[model samples]
Target: MDKIIKTSKTIRAILKVLFWVVAVVSVVILAAILVALFMKGGTALDGGFSITLGNYSLLLNQEYSSQQLTSLHFMTFANVALFGTLSCYIIRVLLNVFEPMSQGKPFSTTISVALKKLAYAILIMGIINLVLQIATNLIFYNVFDIPSLFNADRVESCSISIVSDGSFIIWFFILRLVGHIFKYGETLQQLSDETL
Candidate 1:
């Protein structure tokens, strides 16, 4: 048990560090996109725009039917950054819950409360991700003329994806159920401790 606890603590500490790095990087990237947009001002949407970071790149060169799409590429990056940061934060909260569990107190109120908070965060992020997925599909397929990875039809465009819409809702309910289970466990553990 001591070895397990030590290992758990070590892994959790590493994960916490990684999460902070990821969160910071996400925020920095988002800030960079915003700064670039502001620097360009009105001309930001007038012509082609592209930003490359390492191996990845965002390009908007095709003629768009609506002027609104001129900023869609930037919005896409911003959305990605927001999602990444939020995910890191969620994981960080989860790590907090684990810290107590790793110390041999698995059914405490702190764990239950953190689990509940994590569940709600997952649900909220799920809804936001669903909306973003639809927008992304539309933007990438229609505006950018990028083909779908799942679909073989190259020209056919679709805004909705079953995986994105279905999976998040399913996970939200699952996590909420787990959180309630943990709360029940915490109550039982408290009762046991009191009787002892």
Candidate 2:
């Protein structure tokens, strides 16, 4: 039990650090995008291997009109911010679930509730990501006149893909099953206590 508690605490600490890092990076990206938009001359985001503190890079290389580039940057920043926030929320939920386990109360109702909430949060985040990706792709295709390589028939083949996380869904079901098992165990424990 002590070992489990130690591990849980370590994982929670790591997750907290990751959450803050992501949040800070997202904010920096957002600020950079806004600054670029405000400037009359557009800034280019080149990709290269370098060890710099605040330097950021995007996949796009070609020069774009100021308006188009601003729009693209805004969309990309929004996507990053949205996903980062969702990730932080999921991490926080997991930390909550782990807290009970660290205290040797792994089968508590709080853990079950946290797990259920985490599952739902993941589902919602996936759906939102799909929608955002499709929309952003459509915007890029139309704005940049980038023809779709996959489908030649369509002028703008902005394909919508469902980001399927099979493992996440599996975990959801597993958590639900475990929740039931915990409830049963609690019932048995209660009965045993009464008899004693």
On TM-score, the candidate that comes out on top is: 2
lDDT of 1 at 99: 89
Error of 1 at 19 (Å): 1.7
Model 1, residue 171: distance off in Å is 1.9
Per-prediction TM-score: 0.68, 0.73
Tens digits of per-residue lDDT for model 1, 54-126: 5977675644333445457566675867688678978888788878868987776787678777777877787
Query: Where does candidate 2 stray beyond 4 Å?
Result: 43-62, 148-175, 182-196
> Which pairs of residues have clashing backbones in candidate 1?
none
* Per-residue C-alpha lDDT of model 2 across residues 1-196, encoded as one tens digit per residue: 8898888888888888987887898788878878777778553543332222237533444555566567777788788878878888888888898887778766666776787778788777767776777778777667655452235764544433445455656766776777677677767766876899
- Look at candidate 1 and tell me the lDDT of residue 163: 57
The lDDT values for all models are 0.70, 0.71
The TM-score obtained by model 2 is 0.73
- In model 1, how large is the Cα lDDT of residue 139? 65
| Candidate 1 residue-pair clash tally | 0
